[model samples]
Target: MKVSIIMGAYNTAPTLPVSIESILQQTYKDWELIICDDCSKDNTYEVALSYAKNYSNIRVIRNEKNSRLAYSLNHCLQYAQGEYVARMDADDFCLPDRLAKQVAFLDTHPEFAVVGGGVMLFDGKVVKKTIFNPEEPKKEFLARGVPFFHPTIMMRKSVYDILEGYWVSDRTKRGQDYDMWFRFYAKGFRGYNLQEPLLRYHDSLSDYAKKSSWDMTWGATKTIWLGFRVCKMPLRFYPWVLKPIVSWLLPKKLIYIIHNKKHNGKEN
Candidate 1:
């Protein structure tokens, strides 16, 4: 399948090369890399241009004015010319077989519009944890707010064109991916999560505090609120009940342990 990989960047020079190299090493070669810069003050545009000049399949675009992440992604979309659209971030790396595996899964299961594989969180060099939600129907996935990581997802261009692309939400300035997935689920679309780790998600230590506490909270709240609304569940369940349990009763480390054990058992 021909795929258009879109990557939006803003001062991500430090990790941009790694992200690009990961794509270059992909087992699937029938793909185009679209990298667009959101008026970054750094040399992001220059780096992108250099790659574009070197690679025929790599296309680069830059905004004259700052447009942030959402707008930058839209800019990349305008240049996309593929049967499928895949999202990639400038700071994350995909496994060599990521595209091939996701494409194969989607081809075999034509009923599912979106397909994503497992993701491994990293702190630069060390692997911290893995995330994988069991494959389920659209309703269950949406109700649980268990999204297949955006970076690991491969979606048909038809899905985006049908959904009219990402939701430009005021609260989702940084959480647009989640918002989009929620909308897809609301529309009775199906999604799947492959069990093998196919992306190296960088949970860099430098931005942990802000990303986890502020950005993630804003995104998660938006997601859960929409899920509850769509599923007709009482909103109180999140804050009054589940939030407390997730925050205190269930520690993250413990959850990680349980998840790892389950995954290991499956492998055995």
Candidate 2:
């Protein structure tokens, strides 16, 4: 199966090498990498261009101006020629077998629209956390938003065509992954999580854990309300009640510990 990887990069030169190396070392060979630069102020575009020159499968493009991430991603989608499209973040690294396994799953199960694996979170050094979601029916995704990590996703291009790609909502800029997932769910598509950590996501200590809490509070609340209530799912208050409390009470380290234990079946 031919898979296309879409990565939207900003100023990620520090960790971009790791991300590129992950794809270069992938066990699957029939894949292409499409990285779109959103006019990064750093040498990100040059680095990507350098890699593209060396690897036939890697292609790099730069935006005319400093558009946001969603616009950059939509730009990348236009260049994809693969049957399946995979999403990646500039600073995140994929496991060597990530593409091979997801491709096998999709080839075997043609009915499923998208497959994503568990995500491992790191602060550039140690493993800080993990995230997972089981194979969920369409209704659950529609009601609660995305059931899997966005970067770990592999979806058929046909699915994108059917869904008309991502919604260009202001919500998308604030929190677009969930918005797109909900729309896909509403279209009667199903989601599956591989139950293994196939990608490592990098997050800054202050930005991901602390600053984003206050910054995204209003947006996250609005997303949940629209996803759960407006979508009309028979719901519980636990997820709504616990997310903010846990975000406030627990340190990022503790959350990672719990996530690792739950997903790996052992403490890290």
Candidate 3:
């Protein structure tokens, strides 16, 4: 089956080349990459266009204005013409067999609508590898946290058709992917995460600090509340909705230490 990889680029000029090169070197050749530049001020558009110019399967689009990631992804979806839709970030690189393995899993498991894999976290140098190996994730799992890595996920085209893409509201702006997973689970669409690491996720402690900001915490809380209502989850889970708020209060150094502990301090 053919897979359409959708990516949104903002100010990722520095890492765009590596990200695109990883896609070009994928073991699965039956795929097309549709990247939308979200009015990046840097040379991200030029770099992506350079690759598209040479590769027939790579297509580049640009937003007239500075649209965010959610809007940009939905725009790319309009031009996608493949059985499966995969998500990619301009700042991350994928393993050679990432697409091939994901495609095989989806083809064999008809019940699953989405599939993601483990990721290797890096910051200039390798940090730690996080593995998410869940056979089937349900609403209960989502109540606590997002079980699937957004950029490492691949889903059926029908899932997008049913979910109508990510919720593009001010409340869900930062946690759009989290909101979408809850909505999908509410609709009885199951997901799985492969144990193997198939992507390199690059970020620093500063990025985590920004992600744990009050605004982002509020957005995540709203997403959880929406999920509880839409999925009919128990009211007891309401407190868990505000769990991310606590993370915002923690020190950045502590957060990094906790994250490192989770991965057993193993560097790739």
Top lDDT hit: 3
Of the pair 1 and 2, which is ahead by lDDT? 2
Per residue, candidate 1 scores C-alpha lDDT tens digits across 148-196 of: 7778888889888887887655556666776777677777788887888
Every candidate's lDDT: 0.75, 0.77, 0.85
List the candidate numbers ranked by TM-score, top first.
Answer: 3, 2, 1
Best by TM-score: 3
Q: Model 3, 161-245: lDDT tens per residue?
A: 8999977777775778988888888788889888788899886787676576677788877778878899899877888877777
Residue 106 alpha-carbon offset, candidate 3, angstroms: 1.2
Output the worst ten-in-a-row residue range by lDDT, candidate 2.
Answer: 259-268
RMSD of each: 4.0, 3.5, 2.2
> What would the per-residue lDDT of candidate 2 be over residues 101-172, giving only the tens digit for each residue?
999999999889999987777877787777666655455543333577789999999998887776665445
Worst 10 residues of 3 by lDDT: 259-268
What's each prediction's TM-score?
0.83, 0.83, 0.94
lDDT of 2: 0.77
